[model samples]
Target chain A: MNRKISIRMSGLGGQGVVTAAHILGVATTLEGLVSTVNPFFGAEKRLAPAESYVRISSSQIDERGEVLYPNIIMIFHPHVITLGKCYTMPFFDGLQPEGILIINSEQPLDLSKEDLTKLGQLNARLFYLPATQIATQVAETELSTNIAMLGGLVGVTRLVSVEAIRESLAERFGGRKFLASATTAALDDVLKSKFAQVTQLVDRNMEVVHKASEAVQEYFIKKKEAGSLCMLR
Target chain B: MIEQKIVEPEYLFFQADREEVFITGSEALKEAIKRANVDMAISYPITPQSESMHLVGDLYVEGYVREYFRGENEFAVMSAVAGASMGGVRVFTATGGPGTLRAFEIFPAWAGARVPVVCAFMTRGVNSPLSIQPDTIEMAFMLHTGIVMFHAETAQDLYDMLLKAFVIAEKPDVHIPVGVFADGFFVTHTREKVKIDPAEIKLPPYNPYSSPVPVMDMENVPVRHMRDPFVMKSNFISYAAHASWQQEILAAAERARKHIHKYLGGLVETENEEAEILIIASGTAVSQSREAIALACQEGLNAGLVKIKSIRPFPEEEIRKLTQKAKAVIVPEFNRVGWLCKEIKSVVEDNTKVVGGPRVFGGMTMPPHLILAEIRRCSQ
Candidate 1:
C-alpha cells in the first residue's frame, strides 16, 4: 500500500520556499514516486509570508492544496515563527505525533520550555540548519537557500535520494527545457537574470546541497550517540 | 436535410498504449490538447487557467499548434474562438471565475451555432470581494448553459476528459461546446502522474464540413454565417426558433451521454456496492469522499461513494440508481450554494434522505474529517 506523506514549507516570499517545494516534488517523481506541490503566497512585493505544500506517495494522492497535519514541516525563514508571520496563530498547530520539523536557522532554536515540552509530548524530532548561511557561503547567493533547504529535506527524511535531487536540479536549472512550456521559459528567464554572476549555477547549488545534507547526517549521528536525546537550543 | 454524419473522433490523443509522465493538471490538460492537434487556441489569461494556455502558447513553436495568442479579455477571446472554430479548425480556450462570467453571454450563442469548440474551466471564486482562490460558485452559474460539462477529480481525469471533450462535443448530432472543469490550484497547481497518449500516435484532423453550421473559410461557406436562418426572419419565427434551438442544444447534450461513456469511460463511478449510506460528490470532493468512506468502513459503518464525473446532463439516472437503496445520501461540495445537493434533491425526491452541508467556500479545504463526520451522521 502506497501511503502519502504530507510536507509544509514556510518562509518569506524571497526565500524560494515555493521553488524548494517544486524541486522536492520533482525529486520525488525522479524516484518513481508521485508528488504534488501547491504554493500559497501572499507577497504584495517580496519578503511577505509565504508557504508551499507538498505531498508525496507511491500510489495516487487525493488531497490537494495545503498539507494539513503534516509529518514534515520545513521553515525557510525563522521570522515566520518568531515574528508570528504564519498564516495561522500557532505555526505548528496540527503537526502529527512523531512529526519532523526542520528549521532553516543558523543555530538550533532557543525554544521556550513550554515549546520543548510540547515537542517531547508529541515525540517530535527537531533539526535546524544554517540554510541561508550555507547558501551564501557555498552557492555565493542568498537565492540558493532553497537549494540548501531541499538538501536538508533529503538528508532529514531520506524520502528522496541525493542523486535524484541532483538530477532534478540540473533538469530545472541547467538551461534544459524539462517540460518546455511558456511558464518554464519564463522561469528560465528569471533564473538567467538571477544567477547571472554564478558561472555554474547548478554546480554551485549542488555544493550547498551536499554541505547541508552532510550537516544533517552529522546531526543524526550526534543525536543517536547522545542517548536518544533531542538536543534543544 | 441535416446530414447525419456523426463525428467519431479519429484523433484521440492516444490510440495505442499510453506513455506516463509526472506533471501538473495544467500541463496534463495542455498535453491532451496538443495531442488532439488543436488548430487554434484563443485564450485570455486568468488564474488557474493562464498556466495551461501560456504553456499551450509554446506549442505554436513546436508545430503541434498552428496559432495561439492572448486575446484582450474573456468576451473577446470567446468571440475570437467562435470565429476560429467557424473558420474550420479545432479551436480551444479556457477561463475560470470572473473570466467565465465575463465570457458568459457568448456561450449560448456558441450552443446555437453548434460549434464543437472545447473549453476548459479550472474553477475559482469570482470577484467583488476579489479572490483568486478555488471555488465552484461559478460552475453553479454555468450549470444552466447548454455546454456539455465534465468535472474531473485528478490530473489524470483532467487529461482524459479534455481529449474526450473534443470527441463528444463534435458528435455531429451533439455539437454543443464542452467545458471540462476542475478546481483551481487543487488540480491546476498540483503535480501528479498523468499518462499521456504516445507521441507517435496523433489525433485525427478536425473536419469543418461536418459542422452543423457554415464553415467560414470563404469556400462553400454560408453568406450570413453569423445569423441563424429562423432568427433572421420574423419576430415570432425568431422567438420560436430560439426556444426550439435551446431545446436542440439540450437534446444534443443528452445525445452526448453515450459518447461520453464511450470515450471517457463513464459519467459516474460508484464505489462500495452493498453499502447502505451513500455519499454523492464531484471533482476533488469525490477524492475526499473516498477517504471518508474508507474511514467509515474502518468504524464498521456501511458507506459508499457516487462520484459524478459528468455534471451537465446531471447524471440523474446514475445518481438515482446509486442512491436508491441507501438510507441517507450525503452531498458534500466545495461551494456554499449547495448546487450538487440541489441537483440531487431535484432527482432523489426523498427529502429526509438527502444531506446538503459540510460545504466549504472561499478556498477553505473540506478536509476528510468533515466528510467523515457527515458520513457518521448519515449512517445513524
Candidate 2:
C-alpha cells in the first residue's frame, strides 16, 4: 500500500547521471511530492564512475540513508554493467516483485530462461533500450543518451509527469546552444517512437505525464492485488 | 549595543541534572546559533566540522532558523559568505584542515579589507597521510594573518568564544576578521554541557568601517598605475604606489591592535603583580596550562599563566612586562616547533630562560595531566 519510488541512475562521470537525478528531484518536487536527491561519487574526475539516487514518496521519508532498494534503476553506460557489479546487485535485491529494471545497451541480451527464472525470482519486469543509438541519431553524440534514458524512464515508471520532466530538462540544459535543442528533440522523439516488442515504450512513454498519472494508478492496483510486500529480496 | 531577552532554556545548563539529556560541542554550536538568532550560515560538510553545518541546514529547513543552503564545495561556500558579509549582513562559515587550506587565499582578502567575518576553524593535520582528527597546527600556521584567534577547551568555552568572536571582530578598530579554533576530533565532535545565557553576554555595537557607505572623498582620489610586466619598465609612480600599500598595511595593523584592546576588556586581562615565571598559551592549551599551573603551585614553582585571549596584536607589551621577573618562560602549543613559540620568544626579552614544550601530535587531544607533567619537568 506504500507508494514510494526510489530511482538510482548509474554511469561514468560526466555522463550527466548526477544532473539527471537532480532534474528528476526538481520535477518530483514540482508534482507536490516529498522527494530527495543525493549524489555519490568517488574521485569524480571526468570519465570516472559515478552514481546518484532520487527518492520520491507520497508521504514523509523517515529513512535518511543510502537507497538499499530501488523501484526503478536507470543505467546510462553499457560498460557500467561490469563496473557496477557489487553496487547493482544490492539495488536489484531491493526491487519489489512488480518493480522495473531499465538498462541502456546497444545490443539487447535476453536473460537465459533458467537465469531469467532466477532474475525474475522477484517477479520484477525488465527492459533494455538502445539509447546510445537514439542519442547518435538525434544529438550526434553519446552524451545525449542520458536524455534518451530520461525519456525511457518516463516510459517505464510513469512516476513523474512528462510535462514536468520536459520543464526540468529545459531548466537544466536549456541554456546551452546546440545541446539544448538536440536534447529536447531527443526526449520528444523517444517519447513518441514505437518499438515492435517495446510496446511499453510507445504506450506508456507518450501519454503527456498528466495522462501518465492514470497509468501509475492502474499499476498500483495490479501491484496491490499481487500483494508485492515492500521488502528487500 | 542591542538588548535582547535571553530565555534560560532547560537544556542550556552547565551541568544537566537529568540523566537523559546531553549534547556534543557540534550540537552546542547549533544550539548557540539558534539561540543567537543567526540568519544565514553556508558551509560544505567536512569531517570533524560537518555537524555544525548539518545542524544549521536542518534547522533552516525546519523553520527554527532562517538560512540559505548553498554549494557542495567549501570554495563556493566561503566565497558565498564573503560576498554576503560585504553586503552588511552577519554570516558565518566553518571548515577544517585541508578545507581551511583551500580557503586560505580568501582569508587575507577578507582580513586586509577589515571584514568582520566570523569562522570556526577545526584544526586538522595537513597533506599526505590525511586525517579527519584534531590538532593545532592549522591555527599556528594562520597566526600571522592578523585574524583575532580564540582557542577554546570546554563546551562552555566553545559557546562563549563564538559569542565573543562576533563582538570583538565587529568593532571598527578590530574589524580585521576573527576565527575560533577548536581541535577537530577532541572538541568538534566531543559532547559536553554548555550554559547558554545570551543576556549575560553583551555583543558590541556594529561599528563597521567599510559598510556600503563610501566614506572616502572622490576629488582627493589617489591613483597608482602598474606598467605591464611584459614591457619590463617601471617609473616613480609604480614605486610610490607600492610604498603606499606597505604603509597602509602597517597603519591597519596599528588600528587593529588598538581596537582589539579596547573591545576585549577583562577577556584579555594582564596580571603581573607577583610571579617569577610567565606562561603564554591560548585556546585549549590555555585550559590545559591552567591545570598545569595548579599542579606547579602544589610543587612550589613560582609560576603564573597569562593566557592570550586576543592573539592578533600578540599582546606584546603585557606579555613582556609579565615575563620580566620570571626565571624561565615555558610555551606548550599543540602545533609542531614553529610560529607561536617563535613569536613569543621574539617578543619576550631579558628572560634568563625560555623553553618550548614538547609538540603534541595533531588531531589528538593532549591531556591536561600530560601538560602538567611537562610543566613540572620544565620547572626542574
lDDT of 2 by residue, B32-127 (tens): 565544556887877667767777666577564456675667777778877777656667878888888887877766766566778888777775
**lDDT per residue as tens, model 1, A57-122:** 887677676777798988898888888767755677778898888888876655655566666677
Summarize candidate 2's per-residue lDDT along A115-173 as a digit string, tens digits: 34534566666666667666666545555566667777776665777877766655544
TM-score for chain B considered on its own, for each of the candidates: 0.93, 0.79
Which residue runs of candidate 1 sit more than 4 Å off their true CA positions? A41-45, A110-117, A175-200, A217-233, B1-15, B221-238
* TM-scores for candidates 1 onward, in order: 0.90, 0.53
Q: What local lDDT score does residue B67 receive in model 2, on the 0 to 100 scale? A: 65
lDDT score at residue B350, model 2, on the 0-100 scale: 62
Specify the poorest-scoring 10-residue window by lDDT in model 1 chain A. A217-226
Query: Which residue pairs collide, candidate 1?
Result: B11-B203, B11-B204
Q: In lDDT terms, which candidate is top?
A: 1
> Highest DockQ among the candidates is held by which one?
1
Q: What is the TM-score of chain B in candidate 1?
A: 0.93
Highest-scoring model, TM-score: 1
C-alpha DockQ for predicted model 1: 0.44
Fraction of reference contacts reproduced per prediction?
Answer: 0.42, 0.00
